[model samples]
Target chain A: MSVIAFAKNWNGKFKNSTFELVSYTKALANQLNTNMVVLSIGEVAEEELKLLGNYGADKVLTVSNPQLNTLTSRAYADIVAKAANSVEAEVIVLSDNNSGKAIAPRVSVKLKAGHVAAVQELPLSLDPFVVKKSVFSGKAFGHIQIKSDKKILTIAKNCFGLVANPCDVAIEEFALDIDTNLFKVKIIQEEEQKDKVILSDADIVVSAGRGMRSPENWTPVEELAEVLGAATACSRPVSDEGWRGHEEHVGQTGKVIAPNLYIAAGISGAIQHVAGISRSKCIVAINTDPEAPIFSVADYGIVGDVMDVLPRLTKALRNSKS
Target chain B: MKILVCISNVPDTTTKVKFKEGDSLFDDSGVQWIINPWDELALTRAMELKEDAGNSVNEICVIHVGGASADATLRKALAIGADKAVRIDACPADAYHVAGQIAEYLKENPFDIILSGIESSDYNGSSVGAMIAEFMDYPGISSVTSVNLDDDDIQINRAIPGGKQVLKTEAPFVAVVQKGIATEPRIPSMRGIMMARKKPLEVKPAVELEVLTESIKFELPQEKGACKMIDSESAEQLVELLKNEAKVL
Candidate 1:
């Protein structure tokens, strides 16, 4: 029996969050005095599989199937469950991102294992198998306990930083029966941003809100992000209004981001928006309203229009460097 | 084209969360209950799709797994243009049990399209929709922001990490919707509210399923320290602070 950390495959590569998943899974395996195994599907290079060892994974298992090049929730879940069963995994860990959210529940159901999502910390205790997770959209924390013999967990992305405990990983190939018919949900169109800094992986983020007013006004926001080498993001309303893409949305209804520095401009900081970004190491809010709720949580606040603050900040950043 | 929208009643986002019974239960005194905002997005989009598809779309049924406390929310969904409503007469224990009840109901009355919020506002467990799809052996899409029905197939645009993907799937599928599905949720008109009261809200008994997880305790996150107010005129100083004091640069 081992602690299994399922690596998320996206756009034909492992998501960067896999490191964080392995880091926490290693901690759990250490607590349980067991091995940490890294599981992935589809074809992956040997060097990519070996990278799991840098994060303390003892073994790497891959299911190289051409059929799994595109994600189908049911089939992906089946393969993961089979891998867990093969190892007699005591616990399965996955990052609670897009693919994980779709697959974790089905994997839990297949294994009849108790599952928890958006876990923030390592296990407080394992005798009863207690883990802490965000509840009520990050307003509070719930210490959840799994009553079943098997456990499946989805760690909230970026909260637990990766810790390296390098080991000589033993690699092996695992096979599962694939039903081609299950791939009914066809991904007819997909566009990957190969060069842009992903919001979840960025250390610094410049997020705009409705205060940007129009999509045309996003130039300074993008300029500021470029100046700082940060990723660009927006509040839920901004994304809903089509001012920005939904993938750039950061809020309870969208993506939860925990960056080293999060700068919010013109965002009122609704509880839902704050839920996603409250984990930032330092938050700077720029808004016209002095009483905006975002100021309450911000480490620093600048009372001004986002339109005004953004350009000045960008100019200052540009001038300071030159 | 029968469509089902799943609704979850949650406390208002502004509500200060409280725990009781040795931190084992939620404290609900004087709390305002509202439809899960994301679920409202799902309900509104389903209604719009039904309206757009016209007579081809047969009905829109809203479902929930809760007792009387959720009736008002279900009624709100009906008022927003759901043709009918179904309330499973039990409190949902967890995502799995809730998915089981919905799947059991769908087993008898399968809808062409099942829509739910990507995650519930309270627990934020994004499992029920996928679990339901798995239980029913149907195609499921998550974080879906756009949906269009063409004959028996549904074209869905779902959010990925750096972009969105357009997926094509046949009917008898499930979609977990998020913010971009609709700009603003529909508000119930006076006539709609009046009609909603008479709409069928069939209360069905919940299926028996063992809850796999239990909440041992709940606690509020630590309060943040006071914000340091920076003069709006001193934007350059703030940049300097970021570089030197905060060291985020």
Candidate 2:
């Protein structure tokens, strides 16, 4: 009859996505009126888990072991499942992020819990654990109910705002008998894309596409992001040509994003790309093709060659900043 | 290198997204279907692994969990050179249900390698592969960008927060393939297309897992305001408009 959340750890430093996730989950905790426990797995420090109090966690449940440093599907899932069972938690939440996406269902299956992914809102009903989630690539919302003893949820990024609290909570570390052999796969090293914003977490995003013509012309798009402090994204076709990294691709086939503002330049918004980002609060489309599908959904649409339009816009933003 | 790749039939990337009239059901009127674009990456990578293994790669089997519409996608995989295909002839609404069907099928025939798309473009749930891997008790890695097999061991280049990680595992594992891993998925050659005609395609009914969620309604987002134009003469004017008008930054 309690709620618990898992806060993500990226390297030694906290990831912005993790903080956003914790902040948002607190909203759900407040609505439920249940004790909230925030847990950080593996060797993440005790002090780190305590930070969850500010994000709405009533208590911090941490398990520290050197063996937990490398994340394996089996090991991580085992720890999470064990913790939930021991605590008899009614609800469990995690970021609908890389590791969470991979392990959430497995944990749900183990707990015999009803699971919901891509959640954008708190529950309208506590019993049956009914919650609202975006489905069909954000084309609609599905009301999901958990028909089991526990419910698992993967909350979408930036969907809920985090509110900071002043109270501090103490951390309680648990000893887990983890079996590393169960993890059939092992990671040697992880490499991240540079000069790009993660589409899933970007608050304001600027995207380009084949309309930019080639990789050489991507500078203007990058410049706009720099000035706006926005993330860089692309249409599927751009990623196909290697003009941009795969991480930047935003479409039904790449990533689903719901940023505060999405600025698409030199990109003809395909239906698939639109499906992915249509949930953005505001979209500004800049393209030379007046009839581009992008204009159909844009808050502000401009018909002009990006080669000329982007430079002017970048210059405008820079001059304004100075 | 016995490879297993999962595929889903999805609306073509360019297909307009609109639900059926008066309901949350998808509108199929003008919607053309294709192999989920993401699944194409998984299928191609599996075929490549089977090629590299040669004799060691006994077979490359394709699997699908859907209604009859999924058959076309399975044949498309066969056209791309999979030796055989399976269709769990049930329409699934949840990841757990679909994963259950695929997992049950795999239990009968253990594969050395399981490949799947990072996410299905239609539902875009992105959870089936991991559930299948867990059900079958195999090591699983999702969103793998590049893969290489050396001496019965697989090395994966995985996308991560700061950079990509190099992951290594033995055969009998699972990976959800992502885009940008290969050139456009190879269209089946005419010969392969012809041979696909004779390949084995087994169809089984989908398992019934209890439905957990129901759709109340599908609402299209609110329309945006019309475009505001800025004359191109002065950058200062454009900046003034952005700062004072659009207020995006």
Candidate 3:
């Protein structure tokens, strides 16, 4: 039996999340006394694939079908399921992102494997194959056990940091016939966000809410984010009022992020909002209300008006850097 | 055209999470149940489409895989504008099991369009929609923000990592929707609520399926310590703390 780790790429370049996944599955493979094989689909250069070996992949299996460039859930699942069956994989792992959420379940159905998503830790017990995951939108944790011999798990973002364990790695091509008929959904157009830090992958995030008062007063927030190289986020009300795009809403219903540092300005910490940012390594909250719920979870609290505080903070950071 | 919206009965968003049975199960005592927020939005969008005369949508049905207690949630869905309700009589064991039960039902009773939330607020698995699509061999779209029906073709807009993706597909598909699907969920009117009680709520036995995962225990996240207050005038001090004390900068 072997372990399979699905590696994802964007324009043939692997990101930090893919490296973290490979490192995580490598540790799991070691614990199980087995070899870990990294699987890549679509286009990725040989040297870029070899970088996965630095994180402990015993071998890399890749399928370079140009038709596979765009993700079709059914076709990707079919390829992953076939790869798992070929190696008689006991465990299959994928990142708990959009693609993984779409494809992992289908793979589980194909393999008849017990599946878990957003798993936060390695198995607690090998005998029962138990792992821990967040439930209730990170309000609590659940220890889940997979009963099937074949198991599929999607690792949560930023849960397991990257670790390098270089080793001799072999690359092999996995051949599969392209079946374009399964591509039922046809993409008509694509709009890619340019020259901005993706919220899910950002290490530091600077966010605000209605306390900024209006959308026009967002210059300070954007200036601070630009100075710190952080992504900007907003509360639900901010998005609901059309002050910011819905994509910038970070909360239980929106994006659940676990950045290294999260700075909230002028936002009253609602339970739903707190649920999303509670995983950040450090939280700094600034609000006029001393009793705001956000202060309770924050590592540092500042009681002041956001308009006054934001510019001051931005100036301070700029001065400190200069 | 027929539309099936999958609903999940979850605790209210403000409900404090607690577990009973030696931490093996969620403690439901005094916990008010409501339709999963995302599912409610999906149902709201379906209702909107059905209300538009230009669309061919005729029937709107809601389905849930749970025990009898979830019937109230289904009624709530009906009151919010579903034409009928279905309750597969069984406890939802896991995502795989729930998707399987729904897939089995659809095999015998197929709908033109199937809608589900991107993830349930409770378990937050984000799996059942695609799994159902796979099981039924239908196209599945995730992170869908807006779904429109132009004649018989379905146009969908979804949020990708950096930007948005626009796609087109036919009927007999699953669209897993998120926040922007509907601006707001509709509240049930007095007349609608009265009529919901008389609406058809068919209960069917669950098909046999293998249970894949089991929960062994549940625990709350660790409590954070008291916040270290920083003087508002001294903004630079906070930056120093971030660089020296927190080491995040």
**Each model's iRMS:** 1.9, 2.6, 0.8
Best by the DockQ measure: 3
lDDT of each: 0.87, 0.77, 0.93
All DockQ scores: 0.73, 0.55, 0.86
Q: A1-322, model 1: which lDDT tens digit per residue?
A: 8889888766456655888888889998989999888898887887888888888987989888877777788788988898999999999999888888999988877888889999998898898899999998888899989999999999987778889889998989896678877788888898778778889779999999988889999999999999999999999888877778777888877777888899999999998899889888899999999999999999999999888888999998999999
Candidate 3 structure, TM-score to reference: 0.99
In model 1, where do residues sit more than 4 Å from their true spots?
A: A319-322, B53-55, B233-237, B243-245
User: Which ten residues in a row are the worst by lDDT in model 3 chain A?
Assistant: A64-73
lDDT (C-alpha) at residue A235 in model 3? 98
lDDT of 2 by residue, A1-322 (tens): 6777877676544565676677766666677776667778767755666566666566777777766666676778888888887777788888888888887878876776767788887786876477777766765566666666678888887777677764677788867777858866676765566666666667799899888988998888888888888888899888877888777888777778888788888778877788889878778888887889898888776678888888888887777778
Chain A superposition TM-score, candidate 1: 0.93
lDDT of 3 by residue, B124-239 (tens): 88899999998898889999999999889889998888888999997899999998999888999999999999999999999999999988899999999989999999999999
What does the i-RMS of model 3 come to?
Answer: 0.8
Q: What is the TM-score of each candidate against the true structure?
A: 0.95, 0.93, 0.99
What are the RMSD figures for all models against the true structure?
A: 2.0, 2.5, 1.0
- Measured by TM-score, the strongest candidate is 3
Candidate 3 runs further than 4 Å off: none
